[model samples]
Target: MLKLFYTPHTSALATRIVLEEVGAKYEITLIDFEKNEQCSPEYLKINPRGRVPSLVTDSGVLTETPALLVYLAQLFPQSRLAPIDDPYLFAEVQSFNSFICSNLHVAHSHRMRGHRWADEPAAIEAMKRKVPQTVKVAFEQVERHLLRGPWVLGEQYTVSDAYLFTMAQWMEADGVDPSSFPKVLDHRNRMSLRPAVRSALRQELGDQ
Candidate 1:
């Protein structure tokens, strides 16, 4: 069985979402950030960076949500989470993947640790102002792509949409307007309505 170490409301949510979509049997090991379990030596050995997401599979240990998603998609091509045997589709998957990673994910990381970015009060102040702008731009780009339909890639609910939906959860706290991006709002709603997403959310939360 595959074992995934993760915390809720983190990028690890993306991995959980994908695993649910693929119908892959796996065990989730919760890592409590509040308890500092992620920083422990055992967890550190799996991921030296102390990240919340680390997948231990029969093949090997996989870290990083995007890498794991792509890996799993390829491993189970019939799931249609990602493209296989087609260079163009692979390029598109990677292209959109980078957009989310660099823009949305990185900006969220900054917001999660803005104070640590600088010792002085002034640097923290600057980060607080800039991070929102960065996130907004990324959100706008996502809105543009999602305008096509209920999915980022148009008609296919792939890993790209999963990533977008997971990160868009921050909109409420970050003050990013999903209303302005109507398509994105709809897309998020559509994703939320999926049985797989609901099941995964419940399982991860242990809400029997």
Candidate 2:
């Protein structure tokens, strides 16, 4: 069985959605940010970076949402969660995930995680104030180019969809109007309707 450590409303939700989509038998351990459990020594042992979405596998542990999504898709190829067979298509998937991880996610982080990049209060406030524009610009690129349609890679429902959807959920909180990006909003709505996505969300949000 696979074990996943995660917190609600975080990038880990992408990994959880992939796990559910793959029908993988797994259990999740929540690391409550409110309680600072993520910074505890025990959790630190599991993930040296003390980040959520750490997957404990038979071989070892896997961190990072993009890697975990790809691993699960490849592990259960029958699910067809990714286009692993095609090098180009698979690279496209990787490219999209990388953008979410390196660009979009980082943009969102600046709103509250300004401390990660700055110590001066003025610098932190500046980053926070710039979040709206930076995040809007980042999503504009997705809206105009990166987002390939119905699913990130066009008709196919790849793991990239989950990753994109995860970040899309942050639009409002990041101060960007989701309506500004119709395609991304539509994709988010479509993904929300997926049974696997719903199940993962319900679990994370403790929805019943």
Candidate 3:
């Protein structure tokens, strides 16, 4: 069995979605990042970077949202989370994964984690203010590359769809205009309807 160390409303939700999509059962341990529990000695032992979405497998611990998604995609090939048969399409999937993580995720991180980059309060505030513009720029690229579909990859659903959906869910909170990209909006709505995605959301949001 896998043990997932996660925090709600983080990129970790993507991992949970992938796991659920594959019907994998795992123990979920919530690391209250809001309260700085990730910094605790125990969690730091699990993940030196003190990040959420650490997967403790029989082998060892795994971190990084994109890495975890890729791992699970291979582990459960029947889920068809990725394109292992087509090299070009697989390359495309990897490209999009990096784009979402490097551009989209990094842009939004400035809003909440400015302290990681700068010490001065002014610098932190500047980063926070830059989030909207940065997110807008990144999302615009996502909007442009989004295939004509309810999914990022068009006809087939991939792990990248869940990844993008996780980032898209933060558009409104980051002050990015979600309406500008109607296709992406439709993609998000479609993702919201998936049972796996719904399961992840329920765990992350704690439904009443």
lDDT of 3 at 61: 92
Clashing pairs in 1: none
Encode model 1's per-residue lDDT on 88-175: one tens digit a residue. 9777877887888877888877766675567787777777667778788888887775346757777776787788788888886776
Measured against the true structure, the TM-scores of the candidates, in listed sequence, are 0.92, 0.97, 0.96
User: Residue by residue across 1-208, what tens digits does model 2's lDDT show?
Assistant: 9999989989999999999998999998988988889989999999998888899999999999989999999999999989999999999999989998999999999998898899999999999999999999999989999998888999889999999999999899899999989999999999999999999998977822
Q: Tens digit of lDDT per residue, candidate 3, span 31-69?
A: 886689999998899999999889998889999988899
Residue 152, candidate 3: alpha-carbon lDDT: 75
Error of 1 at 99 (Å): 1.3
For model 1, give the 10-residue run with minimal summed lDDT: 144-153
Which candidate model has the greater lDDT, 1 or 2?
A: 2
Q: Once model 2 is optimally superposed onto the true structure by TM-score, how far is the C-alpha of residue 161 displaced, in angstroms? A: 0.3
Ranking according to lDDT, highest score first: 2, 3, 1
Clashes of each: 0, 0, 0
Clashing pairs in 3: none
Model 2 scores worst on lDDT over the 10 consecutive residues at 199-208
